[model samples]
Target: MSPRSPREISVLVPPDLAPLYPDDPSRIGPYLVLGRLGQGATGTVYAAVDTASDSPGDRLVVVKVLTSPELDSADAYPALEQRLRALSNTDPTRVVVPLTFDSDANPPWVSMPYLAGERLSHYVTRRGGLGTGKLIALATGLAEGLSALHTRGVAHGSLRPSEVLLESHGPHIMECAVAASAERMRGAGATWLSPERFRGGTATPAADVFAWGAVVAFAGTGRVPFGPGEPEEIAERAAEGSFDLDGLPKGLLPVVGRALDPDPERRPSLREVIGAVIAVWQAENAGEDGATGSPGRDELAHVLEREWQAVEPPARVPQVIRLEGRMSNHRPGRALFLAGSVVVALTLVGGGVWGLARAFGPEEDGALAAADTAGERSSSESPSPEDDPLTMVVRFDPAEQESPATGPWLYTPVEPEGELVRGQGVPTHAEWAERWEAAGEPGLAVIDPEAEVLCAKFCAAPQHLFIDEEGRGTWELTGGDFVDYLSWGPVVIVEVTFAEEAREGDDTPREIVRVTELFTD
Candidate 1:
C-alpha cells in the first residue's frame, strides 16, 4: 500500500488507467477497474467511477461482491437476495448501501457507494480519542443505523472498525462483505466479534449490536478492548471480561458495557442501545436547551464537524469504468451465446463476417465462448469492421421475382452504405443525395448472425449486373432463383448489387441474404 493517508490512497498512483497488478481482473461485469480500493477477509474492492451518472460526485462506487445465488442451495438464494437488497432500503443517511449487483455472476459482486470519509479507525488514530460529545454522537448514529438494518431484516454480518466510516455527519456502517447463502460465523478480527461468534454462532441482530459496542469502545480509546493478538487470544480475553475500558466517558460506560455483554442474549437490542446512548448524551449535556430524545439532530452533527471532519478520499478515475454479466449459474453462458455484438479476432469468412464462432453461435449449457473482457453488449456501438468488406456472400432474388425476404444481410454488425451495396464504389454524401433523389434510402439494420437463424424462408445477394456468367443469378436460365427453391444444381457463390427498390425506400429497405452465393450453376 502507498504511504499516503487512508483517504489519500484512493487517488490513482498511475497516470492513465494502469493494470491493477496483473492478477486483478481487467473487468468485473461491465465496470472497468481503475484501481483497487482495498481488500479484507471477504474480497477485494475496486474503486471505479460510473461515467453515466448524471452527477459526478455520485459516481464513485466500490465493487466488491454480492450474494452468490448459484453457489447457494435452491432454497437459500431467494433469502440471501432479500437480505442483500435490504441493504438498499436501509436509511441512506446512516448507511452506505449496495448500488449495483449481478446475482448471476460467479463469485457474485455488489457495488456500493464509496461514501466520502476515512475508516473509523483512521479518524480515532489521527485525533487520538473521541471526546465525550463525539463518542455519544458516534454511538447514537451507529445504533440508529444498525436499527435501520434490523428493520429491513438485514444484519450487517461483519461490523468492525474498518466497516465504519466517520463522515462529516456521523459514523455510517458498511455492508457485510460476504453475500451469505446461510448464516455462519463472520469476520472475527480486531476484537469486534461477539463471544457467541467466537464460539461458532451465526450472525444475528444481537451479534451486530455486540460488534457495535466494540467499534464504539475502540473509537473512545485508540486501544482495542481485548489487547491485540490473534483472534483466539482476543476471544479468550472477551470471555474473561478483562476489558481495557480505560479512557471511555463515564456516562457511556453503562450502555457500552451492556452492549458488549459476553452472551449475545445479554447484549442490548439496537433500539435499547440507541435509547441508552441518547440517555448518556442527555446526562453528559445536562442543563442544556437540547430536546429530550433527539441526540443527533444538531448536537451530534456539531460534534462531528468540530471533531471528525470527513477525510476526503482522493479517488481519481481516468475516464470511469463499469463492471457484470450473469443472469444465473444455470445459464451464465446464455448471455454470451446471444448477440454480444462484441468484436473478436476470428478468421472472417471470405473477408465478410469478422467473427463467426460457436461461442457466439448457440445457446446450450456448458458451452464456453471467447469474448473480449473489457467491453460487453453494444447496440449501435459495436466496433466497425476491421476493414470495409470488399466481397459479400449472399442469396439474391430479383425485384421481378416473387420472394418475401427482409434485409441487406451484411455479415458484420454494420450495415454498408446504400451506394456501396449498389456497386457505385463509395459514393459521397452529394453522390448519395443525387442517387437518392429517386427514393429515400432507409437505414438497413446490420443483421447479427448470432440473432439470425441459419434456416430462413428467403435470402438476397447484391447483384453486380455483370454481363458475364456472374450477373445471372439464374439457376437461370434467367434467375430460377428463390433461395428456398434452389436445392437442386450445386449451390454456388456469387456477388451482386442492390436493385433500385433496395437502394431507395420510403420505409424499410429489403433484406437480401445468400445461404450460399451462386457463381452460376
Candidate 2:
C-alpha cells in the first residue's frame, strides 16, 4: 500500500496552534497561515489551512517557513532551505508522510500533515518522561520509520527529540532528507550527534543510528545521555561517549547502549535496532509475541490518548483564517529556532501592531517571546516555579544524634519538628537539636510552614531542571549520586533531618532536610 501525507491520514485532533504575531505573514504561498506552531533553529513551523480544500484530510497542513534571523543569520538560510527541500523530496517512510515544498515562494517553505500533539521535547519536559510501554512504542515507531528511510538511502542527519513529533498515532520522524553531498548537516546539536560526527564524519546511516540511540535514551529518560552543560562542555563529553543510560530499563539497555557505540562500524543498523526492541518485549511476554511485536502502533496510539488527556494544548488556532480582505504582505519579522544546537525562538516583527484575536492569548513581552517556547507552554499550561516551589534534593548525613558530626548541618531547612511526622508532634530542626542535646534522641525536620524553606544541593534557576521525582534529576551538575536505600518503601523521604549544602553554581549554602540513611562515615 502507498503511504499517505499526514493531512491525508485520518484521526481525531484539532490543530493546536498559537495565533500569528503582528509581524507574521498572513499567507505563505497559497495557504493561509492560521497560527504559529513552533520555532527551532531551522525556522518557524506554522499550522496553516488551505481554504480551497473542502475535504477534512486536505484542509490543514503544517508549513515550515523561514523568517528573518533574529535567531539565525541570512548566511545559513540556504543550508536550512536545503534541509527543507531535502525533507520535501523524500518518499514516505513507515508512518512518516511525504512533504510538499514551495520553492518559488520567498523564504521558501514546505508543507506536511498538521501533526497534533506536543513535540517530544515539550511532552517529556511537561509529563516527566514516557513510561516503559510508550517508550518501547516510541522507539519502535522511530526505528521502523528510520529503517525505511535508510533503505531509500536517506539519513536523517539531525535526529534530536525536537525533530521527532509525538503525535496521537505514534512517533513521526521529520526531516529525513539527506544533503545532496555526503557531507553531514552542520546544525544537528552536539548533544545528540554521534561521536563520528564530532570526528568530522558525515551524517551517514551509521551517524543516524548513533543519534537515534541518543534520541530514544532521552525519550525514555528526560536527561540527555551525557549530563547537561554548555554546548562546548557537552560536545567534549559526548565525543568521549560519557553519558549515562542509567534510568532506562534493563531489557532496553542494549537498544540505546549498542547503538550509541562510538565506532560506527560496531553500531547496529536500524533493522537490528528494531529487532532488539522487539526481542525485549518478546522475551518478557513469551508466547504472546505477535507479528507486529508487543507495543506497536495501536499501543502507542492508546498511550498517547491516555497521557494527552490532561495535557491541554495552548489554545487552538482556527483551522481557517479569513483572508478575503484582511490579507497583507507584511512578512513576519524574523523567527528563531534554537532547538538542539540552536534553541528555537518565535518570529517577531517589532514596531508593528495588530489588534487581531490571538489563539495563544495576549502578546508576551518582546523580551519574553525571545525566550524558548517552553515559556509559552508553561504560561498556557502550568503555574510558574514562583507559584509552586517543589524542587528538592537528597542528603545522607549517616551520623547519629549524640555524636551528630558537627558540620553546617544545622543551617539546612530541618522540617520544623514542632510536631512529629505530619502534625504528629514533629519538632523543628532547632527544637530537635535542643531535644537531641537533652535526651540524645534525634528527630526529623518538619517543614515550618511559617518560614521559607530552601533547597540545599541540586538547586538551580528554572526549577524545572530538578523535577519533583527521584533518581537524582538533571541538575546540570557534574557530580554527586542519589542516596539509594530502596527499602524506604515507595517513599524516598517521609521527610528529613536538617542539613546545609550548596546548590548549583552557588557558594552560599542553603537549607535542606536530610534522609536518615546509614552511610559509612
lDDT of 1 by residue, 1-521 (tens): 54633212122221212123334554556544454444323445555545455565555556764333334555654565676677767777778777766544555677776555556654564467788877877887888888888788777766776567765566777745343222333223537777777776667898888888888888898767888666678778888766887899987888788888887778788878877777776776666655445555665556445545544444433232222343322213212211111111112112111110100101000111111222222222221223323223332222222211222322221222353333435333224323222222223322223321121111221211112222222211112123212311112223322222334335554343222222211
Cα deviation at 331, candidate 2, in Å, is: 6.2
lDDT against true structure, model 2: 0.47
Prediction-by-prediction clash tally: 33, 31
Q: Relative to the unseen true structure, what is the C-alpha lDDT of residue 512 in candidate 1, on a scale of 0 to 100? A: 34
lDDT of 2 at 77: 56
lDDT of 2 at 332: 35
The lDDT per prediction is 0.48, 0.47
Each candidate's root-mean-square deviation in Å? Answer: 26.6, 16.2
Worst 10 residues of 2 by lDDT: 357-366
lDDT string, candidate 2, 394-462, tens digits: 322322221121222221222322432222343322233332112122223322212211221212111
Which segments of candidate 2 are over 4 A away from where they belong?
Answer: 1-16, 56-58, 67-99, 175-188, 287-320, 326-521
TM-score of each: 0.53, 0.54
TM-score of 1: 0.53
